[model samples]
Target: MDEQLHILTGSYALNALEGDERASFEQHALASEQTREEVRGLSAAAAMLAYGVEPVRPPQRVKDNVMAAIRNTRQVPAEAVVTDGAAGAAQRGHDGGVRPGAGADLRLGTGEGSGPEHGSAAGAGAGTDELGARRGRRSAGSGGSGRARPGGSRPGAVRALAAAAGVLLLAGAGLTGWALGQSTENNRLEQELAQAEQTQGAMLGILTSEDAKVATARMADGAVVSVAYAPSLNQGAVTAHGLPELPAGKTYELWLQHDDVMVPAGLMSGASAGSPMMALLEGQLSGATAVGITVEPAGGSPAPTTEPIMVQEL
Candidate 1:
């Protein structure tokens, strides 16, 4: 068996597969009872995980202040199917399972409604028809090149799985086998969250430290972005001002460059070209000598597209 296939079972169980992969894996799973059972167990654990988090109200002025802040900014329009970060439900389409977008690419850790992704975002819609068509073909399907339609089996399956997971969780459902792996996956998610919290804490420390270094990247149009980093912790943040908002289908992607290779750092949320927003750095930054930002398509690119509009040496 392909090790990668085995690894994806957990993400699939969580309904985390990006568009193309999710359809392919479901087809493969239909033939393997082991895979099917694993999905069920993991789905149940996911339900329990959802119940574990405690919801807290945002600060009293948060909404008003945020809304006021964004009132001056223009909205960036997009056509991709975006998912709810936690619920994993597909954003419903106009038609019912009728037309799926070109392809459902999986973009994890993107902000929804707002962080290119925050926890996660999956392409949904046309999911029902896409899965159905792929199932009809009986082989790995091709890349989708159109838009999303009304229905998708995968999104429906996600809803069903969440429902089942909730039932299993509340009912103390026990399986003699496969339960441990499910719990382990839940633990893995918890660990990841804990690590993210730690990173945030580290970033806070770096930003506050007097030893931190700062650099500013100036755009041709008089936009100024200030970046601050701590070499000791390998973390940083960007603050943008006076920049022009991009048109539809374009985004600003940050990169950490070293050894002539560019590692993705972070994505800036949509804001008024002249409005101010700060985004923390993502990805590893060791040995990085400079940071840059570029324009790319909606979801982002595997690599930088051209000369960066903003570049500042560390």
Candidate 2:
């Protein structure tokens, strides 16, 4: 048997192995009967450790918080699962399984008690046949009936049950925490999605409004430009459709011409087919008669350096 395989056996019993390691372990167990028996023995010992553990009482508000969170998360109402609080306490011989004030009379075995020797002795007549007899003797040693002993089967069984219950409670607490985290994340994402949808609707409404229209123009260089106008804002956005990219240090600048005075709009570094660029007007353009574009310096110049590369009558 590979040593790594044996190490995984413990993790497997605890349900900790994941992905390929877990799959490989399952395959190995399926092929090896000896390994399967070892897995069973290890599982039983693990169970004993899990059950013989002293109950850990979470905070007083933990249970209430968990239940409250569950209620908030579930969309539908259902019957509540009843917990036998009193019986659970009686069986564990405590007021609360894990409360600070709860009395714990159970003696938990550790070390060798958790070994495979103790768990896999098998049947009634083995070298450890005296183990059950020892339990009986210890029960007799206690000042009660031959039934109430520390290491007896009944006490061990009860401890196991209590341990299992404690494990379940802890597991539930973990699940609740994870669920709350996921709920918070989901709520955040939903809020973001809703905001995005609202923004998209508003943008769509703006795009289709009567004040907005598409305009097309041809440049002297044989490039075509398409622009979307927002008359209410006295602004228009343009994109060069199939315009050749300018060399480095060259840029496209926008202009608005009213009367004969040309006003600088804005500068763009590059243009791509159908890619929109914002063209912010320098001043009120309600009376503007024409829009034009010129190739200018990187940051743009106060006046045109050359004849208009593209011009469109509004």
Candidate 3:
């Protein structure tokens, strides 16, 4: 019992525990500030989880199902009064009489009458009255329909409908989250593709210009890297071949020598022994005197952290 009461903390925080369990947990929480604080923290976390996701509108099918449940379920009106038609008819005929002739017919308050108009045999006078009385007793407050009691409904069906509605809400939220995630990822990829296209266009302009100048450098490991510059356009492209692979968390970074300071250009792409990697220099090239390469950490650095592996004078 003690263990169960302790377990109610989470349910209490989410407002799921009710009746006796909720009352018990509230009493237990007042005995210890630590438990009270824990409940507060859990409650805040649950609220954050609910607010973190975007809300989605429920689908049409869910609305239809709920409406169908409401329409099928019978509700008792607060001041409704049911009238027993058979009992009313029997009372009206308290002075019993013989079954009337074929031409004689009578009805009171929409209740059946003992006559040939109702296909009653000549000998069914007392038998019909007894049957009517039995039906009236069986369905005293059922408006003489002789069916289930008025205002009764299938509680199990109502509960099942509620459970199904909860499931649909969860499913709708999951699908909405997935759709939002997909949209975000697609936007990122499209931006990257557009930037790549712009960079490729700039690099081609520099390399194909008539005023383009070329410079080459050789690394200690016999790798050849070159830069093509168009001074008129202030743009350039660096191409490297036969560069050896470095360990994880290391990269080749480029720098531009401007007067007395080394300005960071960008990180270089990896190259295999036979395949060449080309990259566009990030910034303007007209003021720089030379281009240099250095080995830096994975995401390059602002300042040169090591000596240049190769330097080519512009």
Assess the local accuracy of residue 110 in candidate 3 as a C-alpha lDDT between 0 and 100.
15
lDDT of 1 by residue, 1-314 (tens): 34555557667545466533543343344234355445444644554565568999999798987665444332211222222111323324533443432122211111245322122111211122233331122222233323233222233223222222221221112211122332234444434333332222232233322334666666788876777665433456665666678888887888988879888886774223444545556666667888888888877888998778888888
Candidates ranked, most accurate by TM-score first: 3, 1, 2
Candidate 2 Cα misplacement greater than 4 A, ranges:
1-206, 219-222, 271-282
- Tens-digit lDDT string for candidate 2 (1-314): 55667567667655566434543453343334355445544555555566577898999898887665443231100101012121133334442443331212211122334433333211111011122232112222323333222232222112222222221221111111111232344444434333322222222212222344556666667765755444532344444544666777787888888889778876753313333333333444567778888888788888888888777877
Error of 1 at 80 (Å): 35
Which stretches in model 3 have alpha-carbon errors above 4 Å?
Answer: 1-188, 271-275
Give me the overall lDDT of model 2. Answer: 0.42
RMSD of 1: 21.4
List of clashing residue pairs for candidate 3: none
Candidate 3 residue-wise lDDT, 1-314, digit = tens: 25666676676645576433443453344333355445434543444466668999999998987675444333322111112111222224444332212111111111234222212111111111122231112223435343323423322211111211111121111111112232244544434333332333333333323355767667788887877665544566677767777788888899989997889888886323344555666564668898988999999999999998888888
The clash tally of candidate 3 reads 0
Instruction: Report per-prediction Cα RMSD to one decimal.
Output: 21.4, 30.9, 37.6
CA lDDT scores, all candidates in order = 0.45, 0.42, 0.46
TM for every model, in the order presented, reads: 0.36, 0.33, 0.39
